[model samples]
Target: MISENKIYFYPIWLRIWHGINAMGILILIVTGINMQFSNPKFGLVNFELAVNLHNISGILVTINYLLFFFGNILTSNKRYYRLKRKGLFKRLQLQVDYYTSGMFKNQQPPFPLSEKRKFNPMQKVSYLTVMYLFVPGLVITGLALLFPETIIENVYSVSGIFLTAILHASLGFLVSIFLIIHLYVASIGKNPLNNFKSIINGYHDIHGH
Candidate 1:
């Protein structure tokens, strides 16, 4: 006795890439933590093991990112991340209001899912920033750190490798924060696990789409 609509958004390739990218990012986070904080108090993996796992995860993430980059370029999925400049702020504000206040009051969502609109304004901005800006930054900085010899010897009076390591770690922290927020937001759909199931099955349970 259910009549909810469904839409197929996640293609097989995208789903595969997502699975690998997620696993790689998680492994990188754990291994990065071990390397960054080697204290026996909270650290689980040893430094050497952490370094190895971190490097491997970084490589996997980099490769997966390239797949995502080209996949967007070669597929129709890129439209979801495109920002429509017209009414951008208004749309963003409306979605923000829904998240912050409206949803709490049991109000309907301002921007519901549709065939043409895969994401709201806020999601488009965050996804674009994360996938394009932050992921690339992380990949480049990670590679520089992985091969210290490729790094510049000095910048001003400070070590270039030191700067790269700091930037890389900062990017990792930002990505970690984004991941946490992403997980929490994913649960805000039809049910706690609705979006999670969609990501796995390639079809989102929508309504009136």
Candidate 2:
């Protein structure tokens, strides 16, 4: 068993960013799927509507992402996502074990949430890769598609439009998968709604750490 303590885990700006980012990504995913698999006919919106919405949402998400980037830097909150080389793999293994095995037995996490280290080793690696690498690639590719005339010549050395589309779609697919996994894992907190509630109020109930 673990004791519980309430901590201000998220700040107001972070909460706002999280909410906007989630909504934007969800919209993008829906429209992206619709555009990719138009024959399925399960999309909520038509192809033309989906394309327009996707473009608008993509632009808004880019702005939101930029805000998140600068906010993290200005507030120094980026530290939470940093990965240290020393003992990282070992820590990642422990985290994986906890999630895959120990969690089923109600074991406490090896690295509990704290003010200094908000993310575990596994989370640090995953979030950092997605946020910095994957997201930037997605944005770059999306921008290239949006302004093809400017980039077509520059990228002509490679497959150009075809390669850009493939890269964008691939990154978007990965991000969609990540979002699903993230939601499921968020529910794995002390209470099913604990993690969700934390984002709304900025207070997370810390248990066992």
Instruction: Specify the highest-TM-score model's number.
Output: 1
Candidate 2, poorest ten consecutive residues by summed lDDT: 150-159
Candidate 1 per-residue lDDT over residues 45-145, each given as its tens digit = 97888899999989999998988899789988787778879999999999999999998998888888876788878888999889889899999999988
After TM-score superposition, what is the CA distance of residue 186 in candidate 1 from its true location, in Å?
0.3
Best by lDDT: 1
Instruction: State the weakest 10-residue window (summed lDDT) of model 1.
Output: 1-10
lDDT of 2 at 89: 85
Listed per candidate, the RMSD to the true structure in angstroms reads 2.4, 2.9
Off by over 4 Å in 2: 1-4, 40-42, 153-159
* Backbone N/Cα/C clashes per model: 0, 0
Model 2, 1-209: lDDT tens digits are: 22358788878978988898899999999999989888654767899999999899899989988987887788788789777799888999999999999988988899989787788888788898889988888989998888887566535467678888899999999999899988988898878888998889888888732
Candidate 1 structure lDDT: 0.86
Kindly report which residue pairs in candidate 1 clash with one another.
none
TM-score of each: 0.93, 0.91
